[model samples]
Target: MRVPDWIDETRISYDAVAGSYADMLRGRLAEEPFQRGILGLFAELVRGGGPVADVGCGSGRITGFLAGVGLEVFGIDLSPVMVEVARRDLPGLRFEVGSMTALDLADGSLGGVLAWFSLIHVPDGEVPGVLAEFRRVLRPGGVVLIGFHAGAGVRHLTEGYGGHPMNVYVHRRSAAQVAGWLGEAGFTVEGELVHRPDPKTEGAFVFARR
Candidate 1:
């Protein structure tokens, strides 16, 4: 099968910025109380159910956090360089090169799936397919947590992460729109948290179950 152009572009962009990106976001999770709270609730809900897959786990920050909270989690990302950075930064954890459009996972093998601010790169037309993959890998009642920029339209990012050249499109979406996609993919919407730290940034977390 032919890979999508956006996937290649996204992967290349992340690969170029992986190291600086890791450096920039490292240890910052401790400062975000709301994000920590959402992740904490997710961990509690899926703890002991089974292993979790942190899909699109750029540099494995969330993966490490979830592991620290006692969930058996592994990281997967579209960029091999990102995976390498994650592995080097968190040597004790497992990280792999993979894509959310087609996760390299077994059906019903996961208790939870996390896509923290990673789905922003996925186009709207491909979201349902990605959500379907999430549902396929998760067991019945398995939980899925997704964080995305909450708004509408796409932003073409030509330069990012310390001025590295990039060819990526960041898609902003509404909570209700994402909830509808989850519903179509067979996930029961569980909760939605919209966070606006400032006028320029509007993010959201939508968690659901299979």
Candidate 2:
């Protein structure tokens, strides 16, 4: 399927820096275990054994991690280049080029959804709609784990993300605002965590489930 504008969207776009971005983050995050902790939140919230969907999965780091832990995990990103890098690095897994706002899977098809820092570039107005889409693809009792930079300003990241120019890449909002979006999407937040201790993020991490 052709990628959507939103998926193709973001300033520090995921497509351009696909390989280096993955390499950089994988090296930086592997020892930290923050990513593992965040996904673990989903395991705690959801009841199912999970045929999980890792939305906005750039380069499949978290997706591969979930699979390594024995969960059936499939990843989807908006950038073909990003998906390609993921497949190249992790040949045994499934990674597609798609947007979280319009997942290719069937409704209620997932037991859990993971949105890492992938949504960092999403504008505030678009989050509810995206979350609604997240809700649509998830089972009624599915879990959602979204993590991003939380603050009051509209931040746009630069070329470092390895994406396009028109794609405005960085954006963030308060924790309450994110919680509201999840609620609108029919999710019940089970936990909210601020991982500033990680030294890489300035925002909080939120875990919400349907």
Predicted structure with the largest lDDT when compared to the true one: 1
Provide TM-scores for the models. Answer: 0.98, 0.87
The TM-score, computed over Cα atoms with residue i paired to residue i, of candidate 1 is: 0.98
lDDT of 1 by residue, 1-210 (tens): 999999999999999999999989999998899889989999999999899999999999999999999999999999999999999999999999989998888999999999999999988889999999999999999999999999999889999989999999999999999999999999999999899988898899999999
Report residue 201 deviation for candidate 2 (angstroms): 4.4
Candidate 2 C-alpha error for residue 94, in Å? 0.5
Can you tell me which runs of candidate 1 are displaced by over 4 Å? none
Candidate 2: tens digits of C-alpha lDDT, residues 1-210: 875455555413666677777877775656767656777656656545458888888888888877777788888887788889889988999998777766788988888888887787676677888898888888877888888887767655555644434446567667787887888778998778776764655667778878
lDDT of 2: 0.75
